[model samples]
Target: MCARIIRSLLVVCASLAVAANASAGQVQVAVAANFTAPMQAIASEFEKDTGHSVQASYGATGQFYAQISNGAPFEVFLSADDSTPAKLEKEGQSVEGSRFTYAIGKLVLWSPKEGVVDDKGAVLEKGDFKHLSIANPKAAPYGLAATQTLDKLGLSDTLKGKIVEGQNITQALQFVSTGNAELGLVALSQVYKDGQITAGSVWVVPEAMYQPIRQDALILKKGADNPAAEALVEYLKGPKAAEIIKAYGYTL
Candidate 1:
């Protein structure tokens, strides 16, 4: 009887997945730049598992928030900070009660050159590097955290001239990766994953150096009636997606 029940449950689950695919189409997602890699992986797996496609646009979370406020046709938003989604929900731009924390991001001070940045983040004080890249503090959550970190270290003013700002974290990473900047304050997921540094050297910033970066996701008003959008959002909360996210070095 137990074997029969298990078989029946499998059939039901398969039927549900098929039905979901038949009913939904493609979901347009606005994702924070820091989450680009993992979201791409998650989207690919989600398409394979459920046959629902995702079209993702990655940029600074604040820029996406502004665009959404001005009627961007994004079906869903994956913000780098929790407050943006909450504000959208309050403004009726997103589906109420649809906001949920998806990842807890970690900040890192990274340098493409090995051993250039120590674990204690003493590189900033050394000031030997010609340039330090950071995302636009006014527009990116990671940038804001970088700003707070610099302030906490009392280097905000002293390092002003050495700083180069990128429009988003992706660009900031590019600045450092291509040797345009000696180092950068970037998202940890961008440089490290699966318990190893993907490239270069890194100083993982202490959590107390800045505010918690609790990233969140929400179904936008434009996606309220989109079955694909809702399905994609739900899929992100599933174990498969969580595994992908954690593999990228983000905490659940």
Candidate 2:
């Protein structure tokens, strides 16, 4: 009876060891949609440096906030706007003093078809398109920028009912790409990346049109001591990651 018990105990210990080994080398990240492409590039570099695997979930800022609050097991959050992380820190979901601006987002007007969005400011005011797409301003930073740009350019009222709102920037881009909408307001990173332009006419929105979209990162309290989380932040601030982000058309 004693010999049989010892064997069972050894088997249980081996299973636990395997589970620990699998998780010990990985990090969990929640990233905003706007930074998806660049984050993938950064992840490769981070893994190369620290031998740590990274798993990231991407979505709208508000949607991600909901996920984090519901106790989704994420170690870090890279927000498209600084406010979400600030709110998380204040709400005790993330470590205070760990939130910092990591990148600046740029807004753009783009279309997948020719002559859909003239780079000139006239198209918005011209009001010829049947459908214009923007991410939901309530949940997306890029959506907020799109609204602000219209207000600044005195085109909001003229373009109001013509708008089709998407749940997130990714969806917003899809609305235009799928030919459901003629034009859209989307993140610069998605339009011009990998040394190529998406199939579209793009107008890089002027920085002066809205508040600076200062993107921020936070180390969630669940992972304050995670080695993978620490290494990721360091890698993001390094040269290779910065180059990748810049290539995606975001400002440092």
Give me the candidate number with maximum lDDT.
Answer: 1
Candidate lDDT scores, in order, read 0.93, 0.87
Residue 230 lDDT in model 2? 77
Evaluate residue 244 in candidate 1 and report its C-alpha lDDT on the 0 to 100 scale: 85
Model 2 TM-score?
Answer: 0.87
Candidate 2 per-residue C-alpha lDDT over 1-252 given as tens digits, one digit per residue, 9 for 90 to 100: 999999999999999878766755788999999898899988987777667889988889989998899998999999989888989998998876778788998898898866666666578887888988999999999999999999999889988989999999999998998989988989989888866666768888889998899999989988888878877877788889889988998878
- CA-RMSD of model 2: 6.3
**TM-scores, all models, native as reference:** 0.91, 0.87
Please give, for residues 1-252, the per-residue lDDT of candidate 1 as tens digits: 999999999999999978876875898999999999999999999888768799999999889988998888999999999988888989889888889999999999999888899989998998998999999988899999999999999999999999999999999999998989999999999987777999888999999999999999999999999888889989999999999899888999
Query: Candidate 2 at residue 154, lDDT?
Result: 88
Give the Cα RMSD of candidate 1. Answer: 5.4
